[model samples]
Target chain A: MWEQIRSNQTRTLVLVVAMGLLLLLVGYFLGEAIFGSGIGGLVVAILIWVVMNLFAYFQGDSMILAISRARKISPDDHPRLYNVVEEMKIASGLPKIPDIYIIDDPSPNAFAVGRDPSRASVAITSGLLERLNRDELQGVMAHEISHIKNRDVLLMTFCSVLLGTIVILAWFGSRMMLFGGARGGRRSSGGGGGYATLIIVAVAILLMILAPIAAQLIYYAISRKREYLADASGALYTRYPEGLASALEKIAGSTQELKTANQAFAPMYIINPFRSKGRAASDLTSTHPPISERVRILRSMAGGASLAAYEKAYQEVRGSGRGVIPPSALVGETPVAARKAEAVPAEPGKVERARETSDLLWKYSNYGLVNCECGTKLRVPPKLRGSSIRCPHCGRVNPLSSRP
Target chain B: MDCPACKGVVVVVEYQRIELDYCTKCYGVWFDAGELSLLAERLDLRGAALDVNQIAALPEKKAAEKARGCPICRKKMKKVTLGSAPEVLVDVCTRGDGLWFDGGEVGQVLGQLKDKGAAADEQGRVIDFLGEVFHVRG
Candidate 1:
């Protein structure tokens, strides 16, 4: 595990440096081609890189969180969810519990963000809490915790920084060439400049066309590998492979899309929250492994959850030699205790708990809840004044009055 | 605000820009002043047009059981009967904080509204008559 973390940091550093240089080179070419001055574009490119790097290091998590409109929730606000996060923190032997957050969206999705575990925050949508039973919920939390423990969040942040910069630079370069903005340089440099402009145009086309694909290919490789490792580690942490498998099925099966999930932040989620039917295992552009493939691998794990089991299953499903769990991770790895569906928390009435999960988000946001005898939980406003209430579930009328 | 029925905390969520408070334990929903109307408006359900006006006009109800304190102001709330088919009665805070409904009540209210909308729509009424005549699928 230690070796894996070290390698992860090393790879992230290498990738960032490599991508940064690529960005500067593209900038220099485009600057000379468009502005008649390579130095000006280089300066602008460097400044952009530095600013993005600073943002990714210091405030990337906050920015991502704000974009998603995530609200921080205290333990007392949601004991069930808080407990799951606490359990994972202890299991991972982390220094402290990661901050927990809730998104008001109805989609069943979750993601973790931060530079490290101690500073990390995990957010889950309201739909998730209402849908999964305890074990499944625990499974989801464990996967997120594994990402934090494995430093994948930091890797993803770096990925965002590099990919984001390159895309922006490419877009700018392409726009300039297509829209006649490069004429400034073409006209100023005179006769010899025509040949230079031709070269510039060709280079811009190449960079605009191939640079992002190259960056994305790199991003996809790192992302998919990290996902497998995280899944293995998450199963190991929870000692329950089936839980995550089933949870993934439920998440994937749902038609509800995550309303606020950003493309830049998609790689950080447990599964891509966007609408993508193509299997990530097959698609070069996907940031996640296919849902069916992942679930199949988890279900195939014999005995207890372990890296060795996952590797074996990975080979069996995707064929041998392609799985990415580090050899260091497999060393001294032991099978975790297998959990059955019986271990699921006792919630017999959850099937009837429609939209109650969103209701819970409201409760956390300072609304009131009413429990009906028919197992229907209602989300209520704080300032409500009304008469007789009919239960939507059973049609039973419950009395409401100011005085008892 | 604390849940009036249960002691659990409640959180606010926005649906179509209307903020509604919902309890984690009970799954009940609450709407604040004018929020119900706003939600109904957003839902575009026809029956809801009659709800708010009818609710304010209905006679005060005799308490059926122990009256609960308002979750927000801790005062006694007013019991207003929702007057219409698939009728609903909800407790509203006298101080105007909001109204509370047990789980699934929102669906019933919305159902009533939709039913009314369906009834009034010419195409819907025609479809219903034809589907019923042919014993069509649910």
Candidate 2:
């Protein structure tokens, strides 16, 4: 695990440097095209990159939570979720347990975000809670915690911020070239350096069009690999590949769409948010690998839950290519046997699970509950706190106080 | 969520995990995109009686009432007619956020659905539950 983390950090540095170089190059060309010099554009690019890095380093997690409309919850809000996260925390040997958040959307998905393991947080949708059972929930939580433990969260944060900067700079440059190029063109036409200026402007336009696409491709490539690594680590932590495999199957089978997910935030989710029916074509542009392939890899791990086991399964499933887990991390690794499933009480029915999930969301939304004597539970919103509500089932009038 | 019709604050009333937001002032009910289906499922009415997507995809109706904003997205909702005889006009969010039924419209719409046959018994249960909850009769 330590070796994986170190390698991840090194890769993160290389990614940042590569993206930074791309940004600077784009900036220089755009500056020269627009202002007849590359210095101004390069400075602006550096400034944007630095400012974004600082912002992301300090407030990235909060920003992600805010965008997803996730609310923080203590153990009392959902004991099952908390317990699973705690179990994974201990299993992964993390310094601090990541704060858990719940998004109200009905889509089944989850993601992790933070600067490092100690500062990390995991967010799960209400739909995910409503659908997944104990073992499956543990599987999902373990995957997210693995993301934190392996330092992928930090690397992803920096990469996303850099990607955002590149996209913005490219967009701005293209718009400037379209709307403000006349002045530059006229000036160049009047000078002896007309041909040189025209060539520079043409090159700048081409770069602007290609830069964002290039950055996105790089981001997607890195993100997809990290997902597989996290899955491997998660299985190792839980010592149960079936748990995650089943969870992935459930998530992929769900038809409900996550309302909060957009193109920019799609990569952060466990499954690609904008999923389509055409599997092969979508795989190239998707942030995560195809769900079927991931499930196949997990289900094929015949040995056990060790990194070596996962690597072997991965190679076998992918037809003998280089495996996902780093070679150094698997050196001298003994096969870790998959644990038996934990004994749980009679599993809750679908309706029961839905009720639990909705009850939690209602509580978070500050809906006051009033139980009627006839067995109907009425949830009154805060707006109706001072008013009385009648039971829908039994027609009993329930009085409400201004404050609970 | 604010009532699309009355622009007044709406209170959520939940029973068996099916939540509905209704305005206290206008007594208008708001059924979020999937809540109606949830209610139908609770009542075991499994057919096409409450397919929200189908209802949302219904052609727009030209109504005299002014367009109202959706409580979820705050975008102007379109007027659509649901069911046949005495066609009930309801406000459906263009973005599929929810449907807004004015004062007695919920009962009217369900009453029409019940009259449409086949699932009348199950539909009656939903109507009865809503009537008792909101103190209205279909």
Candidate 3:
């Protein structure tokens, strides 16, 4: 595992550096096209990169959570979710349990974000909580925790921020060139260097257009592989591959789209947020590997829950010689037997699960709950100025302010 | 979410895990994207009466009622008729945020589901629930 982490860190560094170079190159050309000197653009690019890196390092997780409209919850809010996370934290040897958050979207999905395991947080949709059972939920949590443990969250954070910067720079450059580049080139061309200036502007425009696409390609390339690793690690953590396989199956089967997700943040989710049913498995641009393929690989891990077992299963499923896990990490790794499904006491039924999830949403939304004598629970919205609400079921008036 | 018609804060009324945002003053109801289906599924109404996709696909209706903004997106919602015999005009967010039923419209539209010959028991349960929930004194 340490070997895998170290390799991941090295690869992340290489990728970040490569993306940085791309940013600088785009900057240089834009500078030359506009200012007739590459130095100015290169300097600005470096500054942008540094500031963005700092911001992503310090505030990336919060930004993501806010964008997804995720509300933080304590153990009292949802004990089952907290327990699963706690169990995964202990199993993965994490220093501290990650903060948990829930999104109100009906689409089932989850993701992890942080600079490190200690500072990490896991967020799942309300639909995910309502749909998944104990073992399946554990499987999903383990996968997210594996992302934190493997430092994939940090890598993705940096990559997304960098990608955003490049896209913005490219957009600004293209607009500037369209409106002002010709004049700048015309002025420089009058100085006996008109042709060269025009050519540089053209090249700059082309590079500006291609830089974001190139960055996205690189970004997607790095993200897809980490998902498989997380799955393998998640299975190892829980010693159960079927749990994750079925969880993935359920998530993919849902037709609902996550309203808060955008292209930049789509890759951070467990499954591609934008993916619909029947998408081809080998889509090169997708941030996630195909759900069917991932489930197949996980289900093929029949031997046990171990890095070696996962690698064997992965190769067998893919019918390739290459292994997903690092060779060093697989060395001397013995297969650990898969655990039987735990019979959680008094497991809530589907309706109960749905109620619990909605109750949490109501709590976060500042809704006041009023239990009617006829058994219908009324949730008054916070902004409701009325002192009393008539029960929808029993037609009994329930006073709001008198509860305290 | 505020009621699209009354522009007043709406209270959420939940029964059997189906949450409906109801306004106290106007007795209007706001059904976020999937909640209607949830309500229908809970009532075991297998018909297309409450289908969001079908309702959204309904042609825009020219009405005298003033357009209202969706509480979630604040976009101007389109007026569309829901039922055939006595068309109940409702506001649907162009962005698919939700459907907004004006005061008494929920009962009027849901009550018509019985005419379509959907299972009487299921239709009766939903209509009864909606009628009891949205019952407001003039």
- What TM-score does chain A of each model score against the native chain A? 0.86, 0.94, 0.93
Per-residue lDDT over A1-404 for candidate 1, one digit per residue giving the tens place of the 0 to 100 score: 53364373455466666766777778887777777678988988878878998988899999988989888988877777899899999988878899988887656899999898789999998767767877888999999998998888988888778888888888988877778667645575666656657877678678778888788777876787788888887888888998899999989866556879888888899888876554445687888888888899888888568778888888888877765676666777665656655743566334323344554555555545555575544444555556544444455665544212
After superposition, which runs of candidate 2 have C-alpha atoms over 4 Å from their true positions?
A1-18, A180-187, A276-282, A341-343, A385-387, B26-28, B32-51, B54-70, B73-102, B109-138
Query: After TM-score superposition, what is the CA distance of residue B29 in candidate 3 from its true location, in Å?
Result: 2.9
What DockQ results for candidate 2?
0.32
Model 3, runs deviating above 4 Å: A6-17, A182-188, A191-198, A276-280, A342-345, B31-51, B54-101, B107-125, B132-138
- In Å, residue A48's CA in model 1 sits off its true spot by 0.5
- Arranged by DockQ with the best first, the candidates are 3, 2, 1
Off by over 4 Å in 1: A2-18, A178-180, A183-189, A277-281, A334-345, A351-356, A368-404, B1-138
Kindly list the per-residue Cα lDDT of model 2 for residues A1-404, writing each as its tens digit: 43454473455466667877888889898888888778988998889989998998998889989999999989998888899999999999989989999999877999988888788899999888888998999999999998888888887877888889889988988888788763458778788888888888888888898888888887887888888888999899999999999999999876667888867667678888877666683356678898889999888888499888888899998997877777778877888999877777787756677788888888888877787677666666776535667654456777776335
* Candidate whose TM-score is highest: 3
List the global CA lDDT of all models: 0.70, 0.79, 0.81
Best candidate (score: DockQ): 3
Interface RMSD of each: 14.4, 4.0, 3.3
After TM-score superposition, what is the CA distance of residue B103 in candidate 1 from its true location, in Å?
20
**Better candidate by TM-score, 2 or 3:** 3
Per-residue lDDT over A140-235 for candidate 3, one digit per residue giving the tens place of the 0 to 100 score? 999999999988888788788888888878887888778765455667747977777777888888889889988998888779878888999999
CAPRI quality of model 1: incorrect
